[model samples]
Target: MANSNLPNRIIKETQRLLSEPAPGISASPSEVNMRYFNVMILGPTQSPYEGGVFKLELFLSEEYPMIAPKVRFLTKIYHPNIDKLGRICLDILKDKWSPALTIRTVLLSIQALLSAPNPDDPLSENIAKHWKSNEAEALETAKEWTRLYASGA
Candidate 1:
């Protein structure tokens, strides 16, 4: 009963994103599974990730809402909180998740990460070191990646 309601909730949220997306993000179902999703977000203009569309993939489990869904970037990006595997280092996605949080919330958080890079807890040590020592250069690389991979250049 309750255990089988995963697909219904997943469909509802997926439909919600399609119906009324946030200011700069879009999402759709993945080819392999309805439980899996494909998403893209236009970088906010003031952030280093600007002028580009970043891709991410999401996987929602039956226990979602009770447990945080799994999310990973499908596109290559450079930032202190994102690793080579596209895993994001956000507390809410890990230990700090609240049952009330939704896919929309997670996407917004990633967008926020772009405007503010938190080197204190990083997914890439090298990026963190550079972000701390030479912020300008680090932002340049991130911006460059957005220009290259995300902007279709």
Candidate 2:
């Protein structure tokens, strides 16, 4: 809960992964800003997000580990998890966050979310509406948009 603890956790996890290896996540800090980072997560295969590369920006504030870090999509992705503004809707990012939630855990949770998206609890109302009204069409649209924007169609 002290200053930059969240970033420190991220940095440590990144260092650990760099030293070892973690699947589906590649996290690195920007040379200019240690508080800002660039992260890449391989889309969960067999899910609507499969074959997509999710680019994300993570911002850790001075008040960290107490307040969860801010994470947003840098890529144009269409999913129930992400809103149009790229803000991800996850409980861990919100009310449920604890200092114990590591970057790896967050990324893994995202992958799991792709497999079981909670359209009932969405960041984007429009996307949620589509998801509620026409699930198949929404999934196809999400998949198509992912191919068009996140992947080379």
Candidate 3:
């Protein structure tokens, strides 16, 4: 069974997200399942992903507030920190999650991750190696992927 307070928390968070949306990011709870959310993140400007709109899904579990929400990219992106499976290499999404962090903050952190990828700790070692070997080329490929896959969304 889902937590009794979960619905209230989800409702309040959804309302806040709709009322005061974050720049370059938007999320809405699914009508069928309030625990599921459809998210869109506008690629940050000045980055390789600029001018792209990346889709993502976020699912809050019954243990949410005690555990972090599950998030994964639906859009294909050529980023060192993002894997082929669309799992992001972010600490907050893993062991660093805190109950105080809201969906908005998580989205913002994801946006920040897009702006600054840490090749030292990457989801795709090949991409990380490419990034390390030739930064310009890696960035170009990322841009191409953004233009190819993420432009239409």
Candidate 4:
């Protein structure tokens, strides 16, 4: 599809994302599908996932701006808030979503989630339990997983 057919909001947003990307984050629309984006987020320093590069997919539906963009992790991560299938348990991505939010905000939120994993509201019960039971071990596991899968090498 051509940019001529896309909504002005999407075009502006895409331009802003490309021109002024957020720190440690990069997002670009797919050449084949303007509505689909390929995203990469570098793990925050001091976090268990540090030095890792996580990939994600974001797709804006036809009702975008009114509806939250569909997003999912393409890289494996060992975190309580992320499930085995990479589905994330985040309020902004679900019930708390608002049209005012943008893709930059969403990706920033995901990076924050990596910095502060909320085991209390988790997507993976087992990981959550592990987090609650033995946090140090859980952090080590998360670090190991990041090294193994999200090295970006």
The Cα RMSD in angstroms, rounded to one decimal, for candidate 2 relative to the true structure is 3.5
lDDT tens string, model 4, 1-77? 58888999999899999999999999999999999999999999999999999999999999988888888899999
Ranked by TM-score, the better of candidates 1 and 3 is 3
* Backbone collisions counted per model: 0, 0, 0, 0
Clashing pairs in 3: none
Stretches of model 4 off by over 4 angstroms after superposition: none
lDDT of 2 by residue, 1-153 (tens): 223544456567657756755687777767777767688877788877789888888877777667787888878877776888889999998999998776667767766787788888988888888888999998899898878878833
Name the top lDDT candidate. Answer: 4
Ranking 1 against 4 by lDDT, winner: 4
State the lDDT of candidate 1 residue by residue for 1-153, as single tens digits. 132445566767877988989888887777567777788888888999889888898888778888998989888989889999999999999999998898888888888887788999999999999999999999999998988889945
The alpha-carbon lDDT assigned to residue 130 of candidate 1 equals 96
Ranking by lDDT: 4, 3, 1, 2
Worst 10 residues of 3 by lDDT: 1-10
By TM-score, highest first, what's the ranking? 4, 3, 1, 2
Error of 1 at 102 (Å): 0.8
